[model samples]
Target chain A: MKKLTTPLKVEDLKDLKAGDNVTITGYIYTARDAAHKRLVELLEEGKELPIDLEGAIIYYVGPTPAREGEPIGSAGPTTSYRMDSYTPQLLDQGLLGMIGKGKRSQEVKDKIVEKGAVYFAAIGGAAALIKKAIKSAEIVAYEDLGAEAIRKIYVEDFPVTVVNDAHGNDLYQSGRKEYLQWLKEN
Target chain B: MRQIDAGLITESVKKMVMEANYFLPEDVYSTIKEAQDKEEWQLASDILDKILQNADIAKNDQVPMCQDTGMAVVFVEMGQEVSIVNGYIEDAINQGIREGYEEGYLRKSVVGDPLNRVNTKDNTPGIIHYSIVPGDKLKITVAPKGFGSENMSRLKMLKPAEGLEGVKDFVLETVELAGPNPCPPIVVGVGIGGTMEKAAFLAKKSLMRSFDSYNENPFYADLEKELLEKINELGIGPQGFGGKTTALRVFIEYYPTHIAGLPVAVNIQCHAARHKEVVL
Candidate 1:
């Protein structure tokens, strides 16, 4: 697995092909459907975004309530396709990466290549395992959206597989081909 | 008639909700564990390992297994001979759901209005279903429904002439179309032969059945096995990344239907098929 930091460099992503397992550290922001919508609207109106998009990676998640003294609650990626409409808008703003589960639309895939952005697939439904990698978390915007609010979270060795890389490779379609081929051969 | 305090139902629901979210049921946990051995894909096997560990953490720490702790879905089998005192049964169950959600720190996911899009905040007004049976006992089953997979659920009305082939095709097609979005290694619940709504309800209800349990109908039992194999062959694998196990099982529940319409519903449930039952 490759080790990289967010606000990623072109070189950092260039060598990373689709289906390559990765462990990303450094700052990453969290946003789901509601937060993505508002962020896009802000961009359209030429208003200041809550966070700088120039070198940021976004995760689609809305965590549960944290108990007192906990860093955050069980945090996992929500499905990615729900944010498909707003993704191109965010990608245009120099967003470098996205972390979530599921397949993306063809339009989203085209934009990922055009804007030199990447999409990563975190394991869906393994929230507690993912939560252990989070070092800290704080809401950055859209707090009124409840579980759909925006939050900035720090993670260590946050595991993901590159689902869509900037050069136009797609893993969601390709992630299982090897296994299927192997089964056929055996 | 036996008198039962409504408040007792409330307390039982609260406990069940907490338990359902925190503890992965035995059937689900074991199936996932068994999948690790059978999974040929490395990534799929790795995912199964993490899923098993995630359940352990939730159980030991008393935390929700997933962030989407799920919308409370309470299924009550009410006895006709019992009398509920001091409150309505539904209200008591909702009261328990609110407490479990708030006190247990589970995420409140229900929106007050689908279009207006406001969080209900306390997660009240659980999706409660009731069936009146013969005995004087209340059997409450708390099944927290998560939308990751729920969003992928589908229903179809086919011509009676379409027959078994159509039913099989629809179920397989729904799972294929859902891909990784519903979180693979899923539990597919098939409700066939009912009217549209009843079919959908049966599909959701089938998810609450343990994976190891057999359907009384031998034909459906064999069909379930066939469909399960067909799904795994899709190679959707764990979390849709690809693997040997696309789904843990396919459950079918059927009822008598009209001569003209054959309705089948597919309710896709995530690997975290959490449910707890209690009799009061």
Candidate 2:
């Protein structure tokens, strides 16, 4: 396992490989389909974004509202493919990483390699356990969108596996291939 | 004839909604636990561990197991001998969802219109299926369905001649195409036979069955077992990391259909398979 602090630099991701477990600490932004649309639209309009994209990791999540005395409720990654269309533009804007579940389009994977970016996978249904790593969360944009609003969250030791790294390797592809090979041999 | 209060139904549904969201059903929890114990792959085992821990945290802390909280899907078995008083059952049920979402702090994930795409803000108007039975008591089952798996569901209308092989192929193909998106290890609910809509409905309904239960008919029960084996073979594994635990269970629910058509539907459900019920 490796440890990483956010606002990642290009070199910070240079050595990470697919299937490597890592724990991330620092601020990550939350956005899903609705917020991603607005962010891309803002970029198209040449308007400033509410949060900086430079060296920042985005988590594809829409956490439940926090209860009294809790930081956030059931925070976990949503499916990542829905954000594939908007991702290349974000990468161009210096978005360095994403944390979510599932596969990415080949175009997005190629873009990740081109932009020196990383895509991390958090266990999809493990929301309550993942919430423990979230120290604090506050809405950063599009509050009217409710759960789909963009929120900036501070996390400590948030566990994730490198799914797609800067080298263009995809864990979802390799892991299954390796397992199938092992099954055949054994 | 027996009379039942609609308000009582509302209260029960409200409680059921909260309970379903907060607690992982025992059948699902235990099956996951078993999967973890038997899993050989390190990564898959760890993923299963976290899922089990998440359930524990949700139950103890009284928080939702997943952030999606899901749009509530209710199944009603109304007793023919009972008359509901004070209000219509549908209104009562919607009222329950309204109050439960607010009080429980669950996310409101429903959209009022498909095209306009405005959040209903209350998660009202759940997809409800009602059936009339001969009993004097009302039975309600609250199943909160998260969209991750629901979006991956598929329905097919096959020619009668295509038969059993066609059904197996479609189910496998759906799971394969879904890949890691639906949060495997998933529960696959299959509905074979009936009309198109009925097949789809049956598939969704099969998801409500306990994981430990199999179809009553030996032929279908055997097919369910066979399908489960083939699905795990796809190596989707837990969270699609690849392993032997791709699916915890596969359920088949069937009804007689037109001789000309053989309809099949597959409803993929995430590991957080949550449902709770009450008799009134």
Please tell me which predicted candidate would have the highest lDDT against the true structure. 2
Tell me the TM-score of model 2: 0.99
Give lDDT tens digits, candidate 2, residues B79-169.
9999999999999999999899989999999999998889999999898999999989999999999999999999999998889999999
TM-scores for chain A over all candidates: 0.96, 0.98
Enumerate clash totals for all models, in the order shown. Answer: 0, 1
- Docking quality of model 2: it rates as high
Second chain TM-score, each model: 0.99, 0.99
Off by over 4 Å in 2: none
lDDT of 1 by residue, B1-280 (tens): 9999999999999999889999999989999999999887788899899889999998999988989889899899999999999999989999999998999989999889999888889887899999999999999999999999999999999999999999999998999899989888899999998799999999999998977886899999999999999998998889888788889989999999998999999999999999999988
lDDT of each: 0.90, 0.94
Interface RMSD of each: 0.9, 0.7
Candidate 2's displacement at residue B157, Å, is 0.8
